[model samples]
Target chain A: MSLDAPTDHTGLRVMGAEECLERLASVPVGRIAFTGNGKVAILPVHHVVKGVDVCFRTSGGSKIEAAADHASVGFEVDSYDPSTRSGWSVTVSGIATVVDDDGLVVELEASDPTPWTMGDRSREVWIRIRTDELSGRELTRT
Target chain B: MSLDAPTDHTGLRVMGAEECLERLASVPVGRIAFTGNGKVAILPVHHVVKGVDVCFRTSGGSKIEAAADHASVGFEVDSYDPSTRSGWSVTVSGIATVVDDDGLVVELEASDPTPWTMGDRSREVWIRIRTDELSGRELTRT
Candidate 1:
């Protein structure tokens, strides 16, 4: 917290893992970062938090391919209010793997994860991110 | 384009680099994805479009270290409106390097890049991402 800003002007708080996970669950969309084609990539997707896993559906594409390759990934969800100059961001670092367990896939489908994008995504492949570490921070104008 | 949704229900468009750069300029914040400690990391930063480069200021931490190590990075900015289920995202893949030129650093300071977080970041290091490739996609409900 070596911030140069006046202490009275703002506050910075490090949130606990449980609180971070809770914030993640409250958001429907987040960006997933992974390595693909020798480059790091960040793409937005709709995700569902189930137990300790974060799952998202991706049509067989670069993202899915990267997941199948077992890329280390980061998933982030955040919200900011411009007028208030305040926001919180949560990031989960983990290994992303394609979901192939038929029963678990069925369970996820039954849970009704929304793609929220135009496309025939109903039959898209599922990828689950097994969380390894979670960290979050909040910035607020005091 | 392997969408399962009806073609009439949505429209997808690929934007040229110029258009993508335009969208990038309009946004103030984006997520930078890079490899850190053999794991993918994504962190949000306030950035400004500078010529053909994207510039941001980061406190000397993991991100700066990653840049110093010359890791390939992905910088992404996007806007999504839930009401319409539509948005466009632009991703820039490039090598991130620390800005060592004092004159350029002073110019950036005049440009006023916002860190939007807490800390004594005014004298923090500056990182410039030299874009090697730029791509963007738009999803709209027709």
Candidate 2:
């Protein structure tokens, strides 16, 4: 991995696919984009890595309802270091579908997501997206 | 605006139209989503408020190029306070178009952006999205 310092106000580096995915795996927070009422809604989610696909649990409300039709969606994960004035961001674009298998739910229940928000798991819905078409950019303070 | 804490993990707090637009206006940084090569590309942008529309600068590259066809786009601005575990997010979905009017450029140049990223003014392109359709959600930690 290239760890160059950022300079001036214009030091941006492109991150390779593998490096981006690795960084994403380490972080659990990201924004998920989907269509809603002829517009787009971006929501923050706590996600996990299942192979190359990114999975996250959500309640069956607007997000699940809007994405029920398997609409095209985008998932983005990014981390910024303010002290160094550097950061990296990764975006994944794919179709989203609801996962409703009892066996899969059992497996996901065993895994713990580093939750930053407090809430009840009333609506347990899962969203998975393919990671083949992933691209990212990293900015360093040099 | 309802300030009650959300019991569910889903960050769903409805706000008035004016309040929603005000949140989007106050924030200088946001992500812009567009369709590219049959896939969605979400790019972070520094935006300024122009009347009811949101405006931002971009180069004649990936972002501007992909959004040239006036495709359906989504723009989002949000803030999360981990300390209080309270935050809100606003999303705008509309058609995007490239504006090259010098008058508008002069108007935008006079205004200052929050400068959250590092990039030079190599290219000067402006993007505007109508604010007729806007929605938002606020979440308070329980």
Per-residue lDDT of B124 in model 2: 49
Q: What is the TM-score of chain A alone in each candidate?
A: 0.85, 0.80
Determine which window of 10 residues in candidate 1 chain A has minimal summed lDDT: A1-10
What residue pairs are clashing in model 2? A5-A141, A5-A142, A6-A140, A6-A141, A6-A142, A7-A142
- Candidate 1 per-residue lDDT, tens place, B27-121, comes to 77788888877888888887888887898877766455455556689889888887776778898989899889999998998897455766566
- Report lDDT (CA) for all predictions: 0.79, 0.69
- Write the residue-wise lDDT of candidate 2 on A11-102 in tens digits: 55666767768977877667787766665566777678777777777766746445745767788877665456466778887777776777
Stretches of candidate 1 exceeding 4 Å from the true structure: A1-11, A120-123, B1-11
Q: On residues A1-142, what C-alpha lDDT tens digit does candidate 1 reach at each position? A: 3455323212457777788889999877889988877888888887889887799877766455455567789988888876676788899998888898999998998886456755556547789999999988787776
Query: Clashing pairs in model 1?
Result: A2-B120, A3-B119, A3-B120, A4-B119, A4-B120, A119-B5, A120-B3, A120-B4, A120-B5
Give me the TM-scores of chain B across the candidates: 0.86, 0.82
TM-scores for every predicted model: 0.87, 0.80
Kindly give the stretch of ten consecutive residues in candidate 2 chain B with the minimal lDDT sum. B1-10
Best by DockQ: 1
